[model samples]
Target chain A: MNRLACLVVVIGMALPAFAQDARKSGFDYMGPDTQAMQKDDLANPGMLSVLEGETLWNTPTGKAQKSCAACHGDATQSMKGVAARYPAMDDKTQSAIDLAGRIIQCRVERQEAPAPQREGRELLSLSAFVGRQSRDMPISPPQDAKLAATRAQGAALYSARMGQLNFSCAQCHDDNAGGHLGAAPIPQAHPNGYPLYRLEWQSLGSLQRRFRNCMSGMRAEPFAAGSTEAIALEAFLMERAAGMKLETPAVRP
Target chain B: MWRLLGLLAVLVSFDASAQTLVPYRIENGAITQSLTGVKGDAAKGRAIVVERQKGLCLLCHSGPFPEERFQGDLAPSLAGTGSRMSEGEIRLRMVDSTKVNEKTIMPPYYRSEGLERVAANYKAKTLLNAQEIEDVIAFLVSLKDDTQK
Candidate 1:
């Protein structure tokens, strides 16, 4: 009788520990590294957008008669680590610039072309291709004094409350890290896989699109595409994912 | 006896309502049908690729047989995946891609629940039904050129 009682106590203690491990190992965030290795129907389809992006990368436009190739030749070599270093602070602008903003800057300042619309397919695809070149590299945004202030601004945006839902990014991604919003568990909004091909979006999309979605979820007015606030937030997210490998054009739930 | 009959009638009505639900046709399927109808015809699944729509299987995967314009360079092709997976396994993935990977961005065609926050009109319906999923499975199975097993 005493042995049976002792065994029951041991089983009870072991059960909770096992559950904790299971929770830790199970699919909660579905990080990019894991997604890249996992087999799925969407994986191949995501490449179609990449091919489109390649075409856009080389096609010239505007008065400069310059394409992306004009400035950055053979993307595979030139763009190798570019994606992993953005939402970087510009020494000239003294503000944060994400991959999209950088592309627009190139067009406006170098090529002298009109900026593409926020959700344009050409922009999304080009960004997707550039991001893909940096796949598997660790995120490494510059951290000098000029960027420190921007990083601080980004941190504030991450935790600040906005909209009718009154929920900040931290509420779903951090404070309630392992909690479920419904059937889907919330992931720690890592930017390692920007310019991802989300099944929900049914096409390639940028981190900025996801950010806008979160703001809309909060019922707050989303920041415009190239806004300083959005760029700062991107910088902050990239910093958070500093050590993680980049998996651009990744598939997401 | 009367109370028992009334409860039976209510249950029947609820079941009937469940069958007639219509959600978004992100893929090809009879939206008014149950989740069972969302399964694609494996034979016809290949023909459904419309660039932006359902036939996008090649976007991330490369099939064994290569079509020049539609093939993607980033993902592994799906030419002989039927040889790798069982019919039941393919069915489950086609019906709901999430069962395989929670972080997958793939839509759950067989999803019948957990959509409370979606637009109200789509609340009752599933993304796709079982029939469509099965059809897609059939098409995938046919892709196995070498039936080694």
Candidate 2:
């Protein structure tokens, strides 16, 4: 009986590890057979936004008369591993560019098309489709010297004080984490679950929106959208949450 | 001249008292408290939860009452919290919830007494005054529904 009990205990201990390995091997983290059973929302006819992006991707505009399809080919193949390495720095521009910014660049310079407005459905759909390509791939960013420096700059920004309230992001996200600030337990502010659907915002938003919200919370003037500062901050956050699995389109409070 | 001086003194004292009653502000715009109050009405409490300009409690917590949309799923529900705690305990949590859990994201509705420096505009006030604290407490305690699981 003693031996049997010990064997049961050992099996119980190993259960979590087996479960983890199963998850690593493409099993759904939430439950087995769930992903297979789930319908693809993107494929739904209601996903007109994606259809619009597909059209825009193929359409030609501007002086160059080039379409995104001319250079990138089919999105599923070319966009693989793309979203995992966003908010990258461009040496020539001496600035950081998110996936949206990169798409805008392709539209303007490569295709000679008008830059799509930030936060527009064109950009969101394109980004969403691209991000979905790397759904199962682990996030990996190049760790070259320049990228490292940019990540460090973002780290500094994360801890720096701003606004009239004089609170740093670290204060709420780090120092006072897990505690309720009213009715909400402060989440770790991990970037693993980004491009999320926030109940408060009532729409999908990038990590940049959360950063802006933090600034507002601190009563600081928010940096402009697509600013290098916001990009660098994104780099820092993505790096900080390096090992965590990506949960894009996660629902948030 | 003496009568005028006495009247001025009375007016100054009244102003000082009013300032004392004002809430304390953190360097952030959030208000702090010392103790949660007990004078709140359930309706007012509900308003505070959903108020975009005030508590915004629905931003993080789901409660038994489901009428409000956009309830957060991350934090624990507060539907039966009144049963778990006394009114005084609830007040304490409201005033300075950080005292219960240091890592809590919840801001102190009171107890900004030891804050080193606050914004100039908010220096005279606490996050929530004693009355506001009581009001919130009253509201939370009223959430008790014996049939609630």
Candidate 3:
């Protein structure tokens, strides 16, 4: 009887890990008109930023005169599936960093260039270009004991109620995903379709920009782009978005 | 001359006294102690029900205001709340509807006893002031089955 009970407890503990399958990207939640727009590379507005990034990939700059192509060789092969695996835990720093943070790191250390600002156009282009390489790839940020704590903090931040509205991100994205806020539909907000174009902004932007906008919507003060809070939130969102396809430069309303 | 000096004193104290709030308690969707002189204008109430930046009622509750498009459907419609619930019931719900249902999405407009991650500047502040709650209650109660009558 004790052996049977122990087996039951062990199975119960492992059930959660096996229970979940790949979640649908916010892409699946978009209306037909938007879906059609995202499916086509030419019609998609985000491709423009991808093109800008392609330019940056080849153009040499900084003291090393090292373009992305110089070290990585070709983005089509080198950067494939790279974006999907970040905000990954940096082995050296023992902390998580998003794709944009990684791009800045390479520029400052490898290329000997000035550190680009978080919201700058150059960074957006580079991120979009890198993201485009991983288009349709599944998001699967590396996981383990070391990264778990930061990701947990990110998850807490997502559920924590903030501002005068007292709305947690879960209240909308988790509870009300695919629901309407007025005429507009709120997507589940998996970060798959990021470094994308937004009609509201009329240009390419990083995920940090969207985070700031959401903070404003909640009437909470937004953390700075590279701030621990922002990074933790990104790490959390990416973990939650595991299995969703990357749609970098996705256009949003 | 004395009246002029007294008026000056009153003006000086106005800034410090502006944030004072009248307290109330909720129990089972009703105000435990009814507020006296709680006169609310139907006109002001209508404004609060429809405004997004202030009351945010239309964000969750569909109301009878056709002028405002795209009202939410999360909560009970306020189109005919006046004909259904008593004025006292409505007042309590606005004060703190959690007394009736703890998981209600409807935010307490007049109570601030428990909330999380409120901005530093907005601590102890309710989403709507006391007068606004009364005004909203008045607006809700005005929507009677008057057309049939």
Candidate 4:
């Protein structure tokens, strides 16, 4: 009777680990060298953009000639833990907006500057700067009824097979993670890192840029930057990576 | 009439180059006929399977290749594939595994239609040509020994 009871207890203890989807940060999958680079601000190339962003934050531009600092004042204080909670619901549009989208909006609406092109240096710099403020903080996606519906849509997109290859994001990143595709290892694809520097790109990029690269590789029609599809996926990723530490302005191979 | 015939010829040639799938029937979950109506070179097939940018078979399957430093565990091992499945069965899978199992992760190598959101450059382009499919089938058929793994 005691043996059976112990056996039941053992099985009960084992079930949760197997049942729960264990989330891992993308940083866990990278090599020691890459991890070291990300750890040190001086060694990380993405930091240069952060530096540029700091300068841009304080400098006045556009017709109104108001800098981001003029309103927010001291990004380290105002922006801390901010990037961790995006893609947030924009009050005016009632649509999900990622960190980069928020910056572009601020540029256009608040500063009265011309909207910067997507993935351009100015945008990337500001994004990296804002994102860096939330480094090491856990991802905390907003909770709202509308946002939940959007998240559900994002989850559907994540699992839907598309392209000539007929692959979903879940297939490679979820089912085949930690396995090699040729010489490259497939990471769990948590979006904790943004405005990250990729060795292949040799420049800083946003999460949406990474999405397009994967879609193109799958021979799928790549989604445009700031598209509904892009925002939805970003929302889903942020939620999926909930509690994982942010590593914005990260370096990746 | 000659100009009309010439235009027709140009259109036919363009269509042929754009699409490379050869018609083959699926019966009882197998394609009994070879895609090219000719046997393929096992050596060439082996080369294609191992090439990182080509077959990409090792991405989701471990196989008998000893030299490959890494092989995936996402799907079944390719070892003993010949003893496990016939040439026709292998051909059907290579052509389109989704027909056999709707949830299959294997990409359709010989299919070009009914795919969603295909990039402009990849539209009407199959992952492998008819001859290439035969080559892969030939290589898979050679692996009859389960112990080779």
Top candidate (lDDT): 4
> For candidate 1, lDDT tens digit of each residue in A1-253?
6999999999999998887533221123666654653335354456777888899889998789889998899999999999999877666776677788888888888888998776688788888889879987988887666778777888998887554333568756775566544334567788877777777777777788888887765446777787888888888888777767877777777
Better of 2 and 3 by TM-score: 3
lDDT of 3 by residue, A1-253 (tens): 6999999999998998799753666677667887888789888988988898899999998999989899999899999999988887788898878889999999999999999889898998899999999988988888666778888999999888776666788888887776666666777778888887877888777777888888777666776898778888988888888878888878777
DockQ of 3: 0.30
Model 1 bad stretches (over 4 Å): A1-42, B1-149
Best by TM-score: 4
lDDT of 2: 0.62
List clashing residue pairs in candidate 4: none
Fnat per model, in the order given?
0.00, 0.01, 0.32, 0.74
For each candidate, the DockQ is 0.02, 0.08, 0.30, 0.49
TM-score of structure candidate 4: 0.89
Give me the displacement of residue A105 in model 2, in angstroms.
Answer: 2.3
Once fitted onto the true fold, the runs of candidate 2 whose alpha carbons sit more than 4 angstroms away are: A1-48, A156-205, A210-223, A241-253, B1-53, B56-104, B110-130, B137-149
TM-score on alpha carbons, each prediction: 0.55, 0.58, 0.84, 0.89
Which portions of model 4 miss their true places by more than 4 Å?
A: A1-10, A15-21, B1-20, B66-71
| Tens digit of per-residue lDDT, candidate 1, span B28-142 | 2112233344545655656653232444554434455433344543333566767776665565465555445544434455554543233333444554444555566667767
Query: Judged by DockQ, which candidate is best?
Result: 4
Q: How do the residues A24-120 of candidate 2 rate in per-residue lDDT, one tens digit apiece?
A: 2112222323333222455322134445667777887778987778888898898877788777777778767787888888878887777887776
- In angstroms, the error of model 2 at A151 is 2.5
